[model samples]
Target: MAGFLTTHVLDTARGCPAQGLTIALYRIEGGERRHLRTLVTNDDGRTDEQILPASEFRIGDYELVFQAGDYLRATGQAGDAPLFIDEVPIRFGMNEATHYHVPLLLSPYGYSTYRGS
Candidate 1:
């Protein structure tokens, strides 16, 4: 099998999937970040397609930036100014050609991520 990257966001505070959330993927090389693509969460809080398909997948460092602040504000979870949790960036590396799942469990003030199948 070939490797690819996928992700999803769940609104832990609301006890449901985080719809309409924005996600940006970046590839890091030579100590610099290069913008790859931007994706939006569907009704199920998942991208319609893999963020990084095998055709473009590589073994290196990468980052997935979730626009949590915007989603929080839209869902009325953000309070006042200076939100506690804004953009959530998860950095990791792909060392093998296999499936990679990075999921976010998010709330208004905190978030967590893990590798899934």
Candidate 2:
């Protein structure tokens, strides 16, 4: 069987999908971070394509950096400096041959992520 990686983001403050949010996919190896690719959330707060489709699925540790401050500012958040939540990094492991769905529910001050479908 094959597996894939996917993600979703929601703006808790606005109580809606976090559109235009910037995120990146990084592969961690030997205590070092490797640059992969950056993606922007669509209208549904999801990447238009899978982060790692089955064809490219592999067992490893990955990080998704969500640009919280930028998203908030672009979404009409006023003022700057001392932002509670800036770039949020979610690191997770993948070892099973099944879908890995990571979803993020976020606000300016905090955020949360969990295994999702």
Candidate 3:
């Protein structure tokens, strides 16, 4: 089977899905990062489709940039200028042909991610 990548973001501070948040995917090679695609979170805090589908999947390093600054400010979670914890970037390697789910558990001050089924 071919491999693919997916992601989601949750607002830990408010205990709800982070809807309307922006996410960007990039492929890292050598020392450069190539932009792949940008997606916005749905009402369920997930992209409607795979961020990187099987047709474009490859074995390499990739990064997911979550634009948390704007979302935090819009949601009233950011206190002031230069708020702590703005963009969240998760980097990982894909070494096999299968499904990969990377989820972000985010808060106004922190975040976490892990491989999910």
The digit string of per-residue lDDT tens for model 1 on 1-116 reads: 78899998999999999999999999999999999999999999999999999999998999999999999999999998999999999999998999999999999878999999
Model 3 per-residue lDDT tens digits across residues 9-117: 9999999999999999999999799999999999999999999999999999999999999899989999988989889999999999999999999998899999998
Better of 2 and 3 by TM-score: 3
Model 2 Cα lDDT, one tens digit per residue, 4-101: 99999999888999999899989899999997878899999999999878887789999989898899888876256777788999999998889999
On a 0 to 100 scale, what is the lDDT of residue 66 in model 2? 86
The residue pairs found clashing in candidate 1 are: none
TM-score of each: 0.98, 0.94, 0.98
Candidate 3 global CA lDDT score: 0.95
Tell how far residue 70 is off in model 2, in angstroms. 0.6
**Root-mean-square deviation of every model:** 0.6, 1.1, 0.6
